[model samples]
Target chain A: MSGFLDILYFIVPISIAYAAPLIFTAIGGVFSERSGVINIGLEGLMVMGAFVGIVFNLFFVDTFGDWTPWVSILVAMLVSAIFSLMHAVASISFRADQVVSGVAINLLGIAIALFSVKMIYGKGQTDFIQEKIPRFNIPFLQDIPVIGPMFFKSVYGSSILAVAIAILAWFIIFKTPFGLRLRSVGEHPMAADTMGIKVNRIRYIAVIISGGLAGMGGAVYAQTMTNDFGHATINGQGFMALAAMIFGKWHPIGAMGAALFFGFAQALAISSSGIPFMQNVPSVFLYILPYALTIIALAGFIGKANGPKALGDPYIKGSR
Target chain B: MSNRLINVLVPVISIILGLLVGAVVMLVSGYDPIAGYIALWNGIFGDSYAIGETIRQISPYILAGLAVAFAFRTGLFNIGVEGQLIVGWFAAAYVGMAFELPKIIHLPLALLAAAAAGAIWGLIPGLLKATLKVHEVIVTIMMNYIALHLVNALIKVVAKGGFKTDKIQDTASLRSDFLSELTDFSTLHYGIFVALFMVFIMWFILERMKLGYELKSVGFNENAAQYAGMSVKKNIVMAMVISGAFAGLGGAMEALGTFGNMSTRAGFTGIGFDGIAVALLGANTPLGVVFGASLFGSLKYGANNMPNAANIPIEIVSIVIALIIFFVACGYIIRVGLQRIGKNKEAK
Candidate 1:
């Protein structure tokens, strides 16, 4: 009975662990698109972050020992932020087709990361880490019945941080003056410019923050969940996050809710055996669920979801 | 004179700016940008083998670029080229495995199957857009995922314990050992010839045919074309189908000529997405596509090879490509810079 209880305890926290990466990434997506730059390159940025995270963690684990995960997190943020600058320079400064530029960034990120992995390991996969993100039991709250064990015991601590960050993101996006200025820039850049808000600076800040958050998400994923980097590590997570952002109608809390739903779907896919004939369905269906759902969500079946008014439109100073 | 100079100089300036940014990144990482660039240059063009390999790599891009450029000309973003390529590959490979005939008959049959499959794959999004009034971008992106999963599942089911199809029959295979022999066993194949032929055909169709003109007109302004008695929906559908056909041919060549067999694990090679870059860089022209494909192909091939010779990561090349596209897309900076350079030259 105790063993069964323990097993039950793992379900929600593990699901939350899976949800962390998507939550952070989707929040990142919200920041970038809200500033009118569509970051299709999130996948690429995540991949780059994953690779550099693992590479840094691999080297620093012996030196920093248990703190390796923290170091890796910082490394990922820097790499991903640097990578996002390419998009900013292209889409914001250069005023390129945001979609095409995003595609280019995706290709660039994948190619570089894959090529480097090939060079380091002499193959596609990276070396497994000795020190990964350590799992922890939350101090007093872990003793609570049923839900406590699932949420606080044997859970990846990074997921808890993700939830806190999501709330913080909401505060930044809605409650603050800076957030208002940023939203104003996204809704009407010309009007914001006339009101003396630095449109370019806000965009730069948004894209950079987007990249940093996404980079941290990738690092968290590698260190906590997979504990290693490989060619397919980032896979479709970035796109899934994008879908979540859209499905949530670009709201941070809404995006988090969508991400958690996706995480539950993923967890359910593994745990539910009596889902009728779905037991016989291939795993690829689960793999494609978020993307498929995104399409359905975008089809207007979910009602008219609003996007940032200036989304995908390059800001011209005087243009109406 | 200034405009003429700027047209030639913009791409050059983009490339230079891209390289400069790449250099800073390299420097930050404690690597010599000069050494890395030289190695990349040598890897891409140092020898006959490298040149042949680059050309071979460019072959698929030529077709994919044309596919994208065609759709773009009609003002339709056929993002489903990735899916079209996958289905076309499966169809062509299935035909190649199923048939046994004289090489002359079998090859054309296989190629036709690929083209038809691509067109049909393309038609789904077209039909949806035409009938349901859905956006092509969303449909096409969805189709990419669907095609990827479907192909993977199909491969697992059909392989019957194998990961790939039975080796394609000799008659259906587009082996290029003859061309390889002429090039001293370099990777270059007869696919280059095929790509060139397709380019010529694309040019002839777009520039000389009334159907092509109608398609272009529809793309430029659907309402105007509708007023001129052109069927906007039909042209949009046809444009997607034709564009998908080109992408399908790209898959056929890659499978038959390069790999000589189809693996289920190989779905969309991402060349379709890259085709967007090629089309943009090429200005959506058939001949321009060849040059764009060659440049990007070399970058891809070179970037792949760079990590081996230099410590720099291959992703640096992608960063450079993105920067180049950004500069091209903006055009404003390049335009101002060129005018300044021209004014200075006149002063001199």
Candidate 2:
């Protein structure tokens, strides 16, 4: 029984590592959609963040040493925010189709990132980072019983950070005055605008924040999940975060829970060989599990789980 | 300018702006823009072989673009075109290799199988949207990954050889020796004609049929369409099914004509994603997709030769393609800007 428990313990910490990025990105999605901007560019934004984060780490690690990954995380957020301004300008200012603008951002982000990689390294991939963000065991928490070893013995700081951010996000979104204005704009842009809220400006800020957070999510995925940056490093994680956002009913704390669930699913896929019952199962089924679950969850819960009222609509000053 | 003329100018202007962005990237990167452009042009159009290759590359893109455009016209986003295309590619390869029949029967059968596979894949998201009110965008994106992993697994189970299947039977192939000879041994095939035929089919359905009007009406205003006694849900499903058919044919073009073999993939083909840009550039019209696909194909095919000849990374071409879509997505802004300029000139 302890042996079985041991395997579970091993998988728990690894799963949290996978959950970190999803939590951050889902929170990002929540922020954007709550303000009426549907940021389908989350995937692309994640790619930009991952690429810049890894590139920054590779080039600047000598100067910053152990502080390199954290600095790179900040840089990635700024870069991704700047990059997402294109979508903001197109969707909010120019009144271009939001979905179309998002698709364009997705394309441009990956393309520019890969192009720059080639220009800098004369190759399509960035150099692998030698040092990663440090992980730790909680000093007092690890001293407890069965729960302690499974939860706190070996924990990634990034996962802890994701949970903290999700809580902070929930507080900001549900309990703050700014959140009230943001939700008002998403619910009724005309009413919000008439009542002195700057609808477009609020949308721009929300989208920019989404991009920055998504960039950090991507950076965490790179720094913790993978050591190198390439075109494939951030694949599907952003989309999965969107799935988590939807599954969570657009709530930050709920999104973190969904992310944890997905991260567990991923961990099972990766660590199935060590688990007794899962050894004979084909890995393909494991691979398809999360996506299939997302589809089912969306189909099952969407009718009850309403999104922001003006989610995909641009705020026209005179429009009904 | 007339609305039609302004509509026509959007893509043309965006293409120029996209190219200018490419030039800036090139200049900043310290490569000679003139030499790079010349190499790209020569690679695409300077020779018969190059032109043939370009056309060969474009045939699938046209079909993929049509897939995206058709759905766009019906107010549906078909991000799963990549998934549909891959499943279709696998189905075509499977039927081509697994069957024994005359050339006349075998070829069309494989293509039909591909179309069916793609249609079934597309139908799921369509049904989800109609029945559950789940957003098709989210469903399609999820379905793409599901299709990718499931098909990769299925291929491993079905294929006799290692990672790739055997060469497709000649009777099941789309390659035409006559065209290959005409194009100086390029891989150009009968797929081009089929692609043109599909364009006509899309045009006929959208322009001449009552069903087309219904689809467009639903796209323009679903509530209004429902008020007019049309089944909005059915039209939505039908549009996705039809859009998927186009993507299936594109996969057949690649499997039967270009590659003639299927290999396992760990990632998406990206042809479907590129199709989004093509559809946008083409203004969601069948005829426009042809021009859009042509430019996209020529740039992509031409870029393959640039790394060796011009010392420019091929990713620069992707940047250009992406920028084109970006500028084109911002087409409304450009249109308003243009109209303002025209008014200023009129005042002068």
Scanning candidate 1 chain B in windows of ten residues, the lowest lDDT window is B259-268
In model 1, which runs have C-alpha deviations exceeding 4 angstroms? A1-14, A62-65, A114-125, A138-146, A149-152, A265-278, B1-5, B16-52, B124-139, B186-188, B222-232, B264-268, B299-323, B343-348
Off by over 4 Å in 2: A301-303
Residues B132-247, candidate 2, lDDT per residue (tens digit)? 88889888988888988888888888874378888899999999888998989999999999889999999999999999999999999999999999999999999999999889
For candidate 1, what is the DockQ?
0.39
User: Best TM-score goes to which candidate?
Assistant: 2
- What lDDT is reached at residue B175 by model 1? 71
Best by lDDT: 2
Residue-by-residue lDDT tens digits, candidate 1, A198-246: 9999999999998988888888888777778876687667777887888
* Docking level of model 2: medium
- Provide fnat values for all models in the order shown: 0.49, 0.80
